[model samples]
Structure formats: structure tokens, C-alpha cells
Target: MSLARENRIDLVRGLSLLVIFVDHSNLSFSGALQHSRGFCDAAELFVMMAGMSAALAYHPASGAAGFRATASRTLRRSFKLYWIHLLMLAAVVAAVFLLPFIRDPALVREWSLDKLAAQPVRYAVEAIFLRYLPAELDILPLYMLLIAAVPLFFAAIDVAPRLALAASVALWLLAGIFHLNLVDFSQPKGLWYFNPFSWQLVFVCGLLAGLRVRQGQAPFAFSKPLFILAFVFCLVAIPADLVIHLGEYGETTPLRFLISKTSEGPLRLINALAIVYVVFNLDALQRLSPTGWLRPVFAAGRNSLPIFVLGEILSDIVTVSVFGREGIPLALELLAVFVGVAILLGFALHRDRAKRRRSGKPASSLLVASQPEPDYGPETTTEPPSIPDARPNTAT
Candidate 1:
């Protein structure tokens, strides 16, 4: 299998990071990302892309030694994510407690940290175990669980892709049917906002797609009929959501059974895959990706963990600063997005420079076919799989 790297994933993933910041900021500007216009949002893209990243990084393990090596790397990634979650909380805490500019009482409520006084020990333990997700911090726990499952999932893939996907779909169905999810003290129903069991379907789909790419094949074969169907599905979905008033029922809406984000309703999954297919087939995007203007996007995607953490912290800051304010003007929203994106890109570029310096190479634009990557903490290293990671595709 060819070991070629596709920089498009990085570009798309980086774009998703920016969209995520916009979505979580609670500012009216969040609508600019077209999430309200689509059946799926950046969260789906992020999770599925994460699956692909995992497959690319840790799949195709062979003997015991190779298997252990893959496990070691993924374990480090999961552990790094866990501590990074806590570190983000600590940073938020330092800001809330130490910074005199922070006078809003709602900050504690927003972050769901208000109960630390009543049961500090219990809360701390739950947070450490990734059981108690707070506010926007919920997604990482889902990611950690998925990463931890990579070894077993890859094993299943080695035997047969169908087996791995079938098991994933079964688990998703069971989870949705039985209301299965991890406990989150912050929520009324004691469930994570992004349920791992429900979301694994999308992750597994992405894993399969990544495996295809690893085998030097297209993730999804191109066909006129499939492309037309995906486009029509996307085109009709917006009006469909409006017609059903999908989320209007809040918790008990029957339509929620088909479009629920928490449980990753069937429509959401289909729409997400459809979008991936359509976007991947966009020859224009692929052609333009190598342009010099997209260097920032490449950098941000390559340094995703750090960029994501910083984006979250910045979102919190933006949300807090605008708390209790009158409506945020459009001009102000544009400025916030501009500044936030600039900061995130700057950090990414800084990391790239640091990496180049360490590698003893003249600093240059990355994603020029080859470059060394150093995560914000070297916490995302993925060694190539030595085994037959995936069988060649003849009937994608």
C-alpha cells in the first residue's frame, strides 16, 4: 500500500476547528458556519475525521510487538487528551479566580463548576475518570473512549471490515434503543452530550474510509448516481428540517428519534457521510489545496490538539466577555472571529516553527508533500502500521 499523505484532511479538519469555535461561542456569529442550514455540523465532521486520523496513525498492526507499539502510541494520545482536558479546566479556573477582570457569577454556572463546593472529592474523581463532562468539555471524553478502542477495532478490521462495522452499528442501535450513555452530573438525564455509544457508528465509518485511503484507494468510489443522491439529500434536508420542525419537541419530540444529535440520529449519520462524500469528490478543493494561501489551514490541522484547546479557551473568554451585554453587533462578531482565528493560526505557525527548529531544517511552509510534525506536546505521534493495514478495494 502507498504511504502517501493527503493534506486535504488537514485542511478540512482545520476548517472544522474554526467552525467549532464559532459554534460554541454562543454569539450570533455562530450561524455563519452554516450549521443551522445543514443536518450535520462540525461535531460530526470532527468525530469522523478523528476516526480517520486514528486509522491512519495506528492501524495495520502485525505481531505482538507491533500491536504493543500501536497500543502504546494510542494510549499516550488518550492520556494526553485526558490531562489536556483537565489542564484546560485549570486554565479556566485560574482565569476565573485570579483575573480581576472576571466579575460575572454566571461563569461558574456556564462551566458547570458551581457544584465543586458541595462535593469536591466526588466531582474531582468523576472528572478525572472522564465521567462528569462539563459544558463544552464533553466531546473529548467521547474521543478518549474511541481512541482506547482502536486496538480492538483494528483487530476486527483485520479479520474483515464488515465485521468491525457490523459490531459498531449493533452497538449504536442498542445504545439508542436502550438509552445507553455515560453519566454526566451536569446534565439532567445524566448523559453525555456527545454519547460515545451512539457516535461510534460515524467513527467506525470514518475508520473504514481511512483504512481505504491507507490501502492507496479512494475512501469512497466516485459515481454519478451516488454524487447526485448525496447532493439531493443535502439540498432537501434543510427544508425537511424546517418542515418537521425537527428539534421543536425539545426532549420528547418523535422527530428527535430521527434527527437527534445526542444520540446521532440516523438522518444525521447519513447526512454526515453524504457531506464527506460530496466534499471529497470536489476536484476544485483538491486542486486549490496546494495554494500558498492555505498554509495556515494546514498548520492548524497538523497541530489540532493545541489549536482545539486554545479555541475552547478563547470561546470561553468570548462568551464571558459578552455575557449580559446587549446584542453583539455584526461588526463585533466579525472582529472576534478574525482575532480568534488569527490567534489560533498564529499558535499553529509557532508550533510549526518550533518543530522545524528542532529538526534542524530551514523553516518553510508545511504540507509540501513531507514535513515533520510536533504536536503542541509531541502527544499525537502516530507510527505507521507494519502489517497489512487494509485489503485493496475493488468494489468501493
Candidate 2:
């Protein structure tokens, strides 16, 4: 079977990134609207959408030829993530160092060599993408590890997808119950924003969803009943959030905690499922129409990595400078920042597209070639299989 291009997935991803951009800028606008449970719900939806997109992108194909192709493709994508991680690390360090020179010395006092040295060697190791870093650090390190783990994850699922998923869920539950924060002594403050023990389940869920989608087993596709059920679930979640107050629940409550994506809880799983249902069932979203105005947003989605990095950097600057202080007109400032980032992302995407066009290669073909093949399959499903890490495909 051919790999179907899920336009709704792209739309969900596009919307998720936009919402996350605002959420990450909580210091700016969203803080003012902290009482808005809708905003919190939106953030949850964004995370869910991200996981769904991953599922759609990397679901495995059937047979040996398809599996090999998928593995090769996954390796290439992982390599690109590695490069992105390296660039982000360098950029973050440079930004931290330069802040003292560009702004007040006090602005970077937290990043002093003495402060950094006080942390364990594991911090440095985690900083290089082996483990979780401090909360103040960017969450990219977790993503790098997740991308690196993709091949192994896929291989394991190839042997027994259900068993692998069950184990992942069990690990997540165990980590919560026992407060099992497994640290690679090589990496410091190993439990950062994206705790591996908690977050791996999200990735595993995505992998399972992808496998289901590939198998045409997803129940949400083009179904009115599924759509209504998803809608009802979303409606129920709102009141449940109010009653449960998920934020108040600590790690002791694994099921409650996981649902709270902000706290890396299981609720995130339901949120992701709801997002998948909504997107998959929306008939209008399945078709891609090449309109001039929308070309940029789609482009931004296509080249999400660099754009996301730039957005983060820009958000950081805005937060530390104007919005970081109290009494700013947050809503207006947020609008301005969002518009500014959107324009910049649009321009960057357009330029990149132009460059590609000039090179006489179809952008879609390049995108496909750049992506690694899906490696999860019936023959290869197991837990933590021995598959080689995917390499980056720079040609795209």
C-alpha cells in the first residue's frame, strides 16, 4: 500500500504549533488569561495533535521491502533531528553567553560558569542530549533522545506492538508509583520538563496509533459516530478537569498525572485521542488546496524544525525583554509577537521553497526522500529491538 498524505494531520500540526507558540509565551499573553480553561485545553490539544502527527508520519508498512525502506527513512529523519539538536544546543549556549553582553549582566547570572560547574557532570551529558537537563533548559534534549529511540522503538513493535505498548504504559505507571526517576549518572538533573519515564508512553502511543493507521484499523476515520464520541469526550473532559483539578495531583497519581500533559500525565493520552478523532473525522480537512495565502502556513509546517527553533528563540527574547516584566498589555503584545513570528516564518519558508524550486527538484519529492521509512511492522514488533539508529538525509 502507498503512504497516504494525511492533510488533516498537517492541519492539526499547523494549529498545534501555533497554539504552542502562544502557550510557550505564557509570560506574555497567556498569563493574563490564566483563568481561561479554554487556553489550557488548547495547550492539551496541541500536545495531542503533536503525538497524532508523529503517528501519521512514522507508521510502519507491511512486508520486508516496506520494512527496510521504512527503517532507512526513519534513520534519515533521526539524523536530521540530531543535527537540529546540535544546532539548538549551540544556539542556546551562545544566547546564554551573549545575553550578558547584549543585556544586563544580571540577566545571565544564572548561567555563570560557577553555577554550571556546581551541577553534576550529568548535566553536561544531558545537555548534549543523553538525559533531561534543568527545567530552565530547552526541552529539545528530550526530543533528540526520542528521535534517536525511534528505530529501537519501531524494531520492538515489529515483534509485538501490543506487548511493547503495554510495557511502555507499565513503565510509565511504575515510574509514577515508585517515583522512579531513572537518571543516567552521566546526565545531571536528569528529570527535566520531558521526563523520559513519563514521556516515553506518549511516543509509544504515537507509534501504536501509527501502526493502527497503517493497518487501516483506526476507528476515527470518516465516521460520524466516532466524531460525536470524540466531541462528547472533549466536552466531558472540561468538567472533569475542573473537578479533578489535574494540576493539584502530584506524581503519586499516575493515571491522573499522565492525562495532564503539562505535568506529563495520562490525560494527555485521551487528549491526543480526541485530537485524532476530530481531525480524522473532519472531511473538509482531508484535501489539500494550494492557495497562495495558505502556502506560507503550509510551508511553515513543512519546515517546522528551524521555524520552531526560531520561534522559541524569538519568544525567549520577547519574554525576557518586554513581557518578562509585570504590567505589560499582554494580549496586545501577544498578538504582535504572534504576527511577527508568523511573518518571519512565512518569509523563511517562502525563501526556502524558492531555493528548492530553483534547484529543479519537486518539494514534495524532496520531503518524501528526506523522511525515513516507517519501520514498525507485524514481523518486527517486540520491546526495545536492536535496530541501528537512523541517519540524516541532507539531500532534501
Candidate 3:
């Protein structure tokens, strides 16, 4: 089959990164653009896209370099993420500690790291083990763990097309039923905010969808009835889940499991899938113009890891800058959001240009970021695409 690569994933991933910065920046104007308007947020999108990107990057086709080599590379990428997480953790901690202007406790309260300053050594150790998560930073360790498990997921793929998916769902059910989670060091009986046990279900689903893409097919067959149902569900969710009755995970609430972000709540997962289906089936996303208004967005998503790291720092910088202001001006909020996005876009484009330069490839149009690469087999080249390979996460 001729490869029909889709650029929608990059487009959506880039959009999510933008949303993440705006949301985390805590700018008052972010409510309109951030994921708070939905049941699931950018974190969910990034994880699913990460799984899809993993399939593209490390599928057996790429394994012709030798499955051993591929496995080693994937694991190495995981370690690289681990080290980067640590560095980011240190930077975040130091910034919070050393910044004199950030005197307002409320400004830094979201970090939830009151104990960290007192015991840096101990917190560092816990962080190394994927514990002691601070706000906005927990996703890194989760990504690190998931990337490290790619080999196992690929193994299940080899065993049976649906085996991994089945196991993923079963584990998710078990986790929800038993409240399974990795240890959290911040408090007694604490657990990771986004539980990998439950979140794996979505990642595995994305992996399966990507497998279809690798074979030049759409991720899901279109069903008009299903589309209508998903559309209705998403609309209802905005009001029921995000607006009215969007309560916390209160024990007595009927929507307890639905609101629990840690367990990848059932309603939230369904909402995420519903939205994805509606968007993907509409077919508009398939024909996105990479060089159009979203050119910067595509660039940011193409080099997501670096753009993401930069965005987090920028978010904190903005939050700190406005700590004591009586009220955040709309102008500063707008500049923070727009300029932060521009910085990320520039960084992503720079990384893309650097890669093209090093490879001695001619400069590419904006299409370079969204070009669909052929999914090759053994007869095809084993070299991974420079387009954000799950490995060498650096766009280069």
C-alpha cells in the first residue's frame, strides 16, 4: 500500500503544547484557550500523541537496524528524558528558591513543594525514583516511564495485534478498581497525579491507531451513527464536565471516577476519544496547510520536547513576574501567552533548521514539519525520520 501519512497528529500535538503553556502560565485570560474548558486536558493529549509517535519511531520497520538496537535506543531515550527531568526539576526548584520577587506564597503554591526547600537532597532522591512530583512537572517522569516500556508494548504487538490493547484495558480496570498507583513521596499514601496504570489505556489505544497509520489506513473506520453519538457526548461534556457540576473528586459524588484525573477517569477517557473522533473524522485536519496561520504551531509540535521544556520555564517566569501585581493586566497576559508561543515556535524552527544543516539537506518549506513519512519495512531504510522521532526527541 502506498503510504498515506497524516499530519493531523503534529497539528494537534502542537496545539496542545500551546494550550499547556497558556494554562500553566496562570494568566487570567487563559480560561478561554486552556483545556479547562474540557474534561481531559493537554496532558492527556501529549501522552496519547507520545504513544503514536513512539509507534512511528520504534516500530519493527525501524527495528531492521536490529530489534536489539531499537530496544537499546528506546531505553536510552527514556534515560535521556529522566536526566532532563532531573535538570528541569533542579531549575524549577532553584528558580523558586532564588527568585526574591516571588514573595507571595500563593504565587508558588501550585508547585506544592513546601517541604522541598528544607530537604533538597531527600526530595532529589525521591524525584529520581519518580516520586515527590511538583505541579506541572509530574508529566515528565510519566513520559519517562512510558517510553521505557515501549519495548514491552512492541513485544505484545508482535504477539498479537490486540494483545497489548487488551492487557492495557484490563490493567486500567484493575487500577481503577483497586486504586493502584506508583508511590508518591510528598505525603503518606500519595500517588502519582497521572497514573500510568490507568493512562496506559489511552496510550495503547493511540499505539493501535498509529499501527493502522503505519499501514496507510485511517485510525478508525467512520460510522455516521458513532460520530453523532460522540459529537453529542462532547457537547454535553462541556457543560456537565467542565462547567456546571464539575465538582472535585468527592467520595459521595456520582461522578467520582469520572473526575479523578489520576485514574484516567472513565468519563474523561470517553470524552477525549469522542473529541478525537469528531476532529479526525471531519477530515479537515487531514488537509492542514503547514505554512499557513499555524506554521508556528506546527514548528512547536514538531520539536515538542525542547519547545515543551522552554514553555514550562516561560510559564513560571511569567507567573513570577506578576506575583505582586494587584490585578494581572490584560496586556501583560496577552503578551505572555503570545510571546511565549512565539519563542517556542522560533526554537522549534531553529532546531529544524539545525537538523537540515547538519544533514546537508536543503532548507525545507514549512511543509518540512508536517510531511508524512512513509512507513517502511525491511526493504526500506531503517533510519528514522528527522520529524520528531520518539528517539533523539530533539528535533535534530
Candidate 4:
């Protein structure tokens, strides 16, 4: 793929991450915003897009060189994520420890030191990206595991993409059947937000999409009828499930349950798929380019990881200091927070772009540089064109 296309993916991922940050921050109005129709359900979209982006970025090539290249890139990303996880862990710990010193004693009292201490071993295990950590911990362990598993998964796809997808679906079903909650596991899953077993399907679907793209096939571009059907299905399924299940419908439904944000159930997965199909087929959406004002949202999507971490830390501070048990007001305060974060993200992106431009390279090129080079063919005699050193790309 061209550099521009890859950057666009980064932009999408950044946007998804931003929405997720806003969604998970649990600031007062998020619930209502999440419930509203037009709001992007960022969590599911982020997972799905992660899969799609992975497919687009790292599908296997023709020979041993291709396989080696793919493996090296995956490994580098996995390690990078590991480092990021460490940083996030440090941030969370720092926030927890220091918030009390800066904030009122009454506010500090609501903070849960016991909860942090309760799971030392779990947090330690999470450092390896094996299990899910507590919600209070903002890091995503499962995403790291998925990153580590990418090469293996891609190898399987190279041999038999369909088989790989089938296996993923089977595993997903099994995960649901066994109620395979990573949170229940003794080891920490990669991050609190992602669970490998359930989330793998999203990745596999992305792999399938990537395989098609690598084959020079368009992964999207639905017929009008199909698009309409997908749209109707999404509209009906989401609301129907909500109405029928109502309060009883936790994220976990027996057949489809994975790790729902609500309960990590099957319903969420279905909802995610419904959303994906609708978005994938919507030609009109494709026509909608990032406007000048909205470009920052795309930039946020590109640097989703840092922005997400920043938002989480910011939310933690706000909740611990200003809001505490009472919580921020649901209306104006929530809007202000969201707008404030958006502005900050815009500024960060602007600074990052300026830095990259000054350094004489594209930001996407920088991400590629940080990643390990693929170990495919013999070392090249000719040097590849140098791209700019941009910030590391993070999933939203």
C-alpha cells in the first residue's frame, strides 16, 4: 500500500481511540452520549479497525522474504506495545499514588489502594500481556497479546486463510461456551480492554480483509441491495437486542459472549459486526473526507495509544480530585471535558506534525522505522527511501 493509504488507516485508528477514551472515561455524560444513535461506539470499532489495519499493513508476501518481513514487523510491534504497557502502568501507579497528595483527603479516600494491592501478581503477569488487568488500570493487555500472536496468525493465513478464520470462529465459540473470562485467569491478559480469545475473531476478519487487499482485491464496496440489508440489519439488531434484553442483557450472551465491555458478551460482538458491515458497505461514508476541523480527530486516530493513555490519566485525575464519588455533572461538564480533550489532542497532533515536517520525514515513516525490519530476503543492496520519523502509531 502507498504511504498515504497507511496514514489514512492511522488516522482512522486514532479517531477510534479518541472515541474509546471518551467512552471509557466514565465522566458523567458518557452514558447518554454512548446511548445516543449517532455516537460512534468507539470500542468495538477500534477492535474491528485494528484487525482491518493489521491486515492492510502486514499481510504475508509471496516468498520467504515476505514471511520473514511480516514476522519481524509483528515482533517489533509486540515489543513496542510491551514498552508502552510498562509506561502506562507507571503512569497509572503514579496517578494513584500522587493524586492523594494533591487532592483533598475526602477526595483521596474514594481512591482504591486496596484494589491495586489486591492484584500484584495479576499486574505482574499483565506486564507480559497475558491477562486482563483491573478496570482502574487503563492499559490494554489483550491487544499486546494479539500483537504478539500476529505473525503466527499471519503464517496460518498464508497457508490457509479460510482455515485460519474458521479456527478463529471456533475458538471464539469455545471461549463463549466455557465462559473463558481472561479476567478470571491467574495471569494478566494483555490489557484490561481486550481479551485474546474473543477479540481474535476481529483480528481474523481483519486478516481476511488484508489477504484480499494484498491480492489486489477490494475488501469493501457492497452492492446497493446488500448495503441496504446490512444497514437495516444493524439498525434492527442493535435496538432489538437492547429492547428485548433490556437490563438483563449484559455484554455476555451464552453463544456469542467473549469479553464484552459491559460483560464482553456475544451481543457486543454481533453489534460490532453489524456496525462493521454497515460502515464497510456505506459508500457515502467513503465520500466523506476528513474536514479541516475534523482533521485533528483523524490525527488522534493516528496516535490513538498516547491519546488514549493521556485521556485515561486525565479522567482519573478529574474523577479522583474534582468529582470523586459524586462524579462530574452529566450535561455541560461532560461536553466541556470532551471538547477540552479534543482541543488538546489537536494541539498534540499539530506539534507532532510540525516536528516531523522539520525533521524531513512523514510521521508514518517514523512508525515504520521504530518497528523491526522484516527478515525476509537477503539484505538489500540498495537502501529503501527514507521516510520521516513520526510518532509511534497506536490503535484507538
The most accurate candidate by lDDT is 1
**153: Cα error in model 3, Å:** 1.0
Q: Worst lDDT window (10 residues) for model 3?
A: 387-396
For each candidate, what TM-score against the reference? 0.86, 0.71, 0.86, 0.75
Give the deviation of candidate 4 from the true structure as CA RMSD: 7.0
Q: Per-residue lDDT tens digits of candidate 3, residues 1-396?
A: 243445667777778777777777767755444424466666666777777667766665434455666578777877777788788888877777787766567655657677676787888788778788774577777777777787778778867977767788899999988988887766334777768898888778777766666655667779999999999988887666544233433344556676567888887788878877887788777777766787777667666778778888887788776666745889878877888888888887787688667768632321211223433232232211111111100000
Q: Candidate 2 — what's its lDDT?
A: 0.49
Q: lDDT tens string, model 1, 163-220?
A: 8788899999999889898888866566787778998888898888877766667778
When 1 and 4 are scored with lDDT, the better candidate is 1
Write the residue-wise lDDT of candidate 2 on 58-160 in tens digits.
5456566665665666566656666666565556556655665334344444222233435736456655654533213334444545655665677678898
Expressed as tens digits, the lDDT of each residue in 20-39 for candidate 4 is 45555555644544544321
Model 4 spans with C-alpha error above 4 angstroms: 1-12, 37-40, 101-113, 118-132, 136-139, 181-193, 241-264, 330-332, 358-396
What's the number of clashes in each of the models? 0, 30, 0, 27
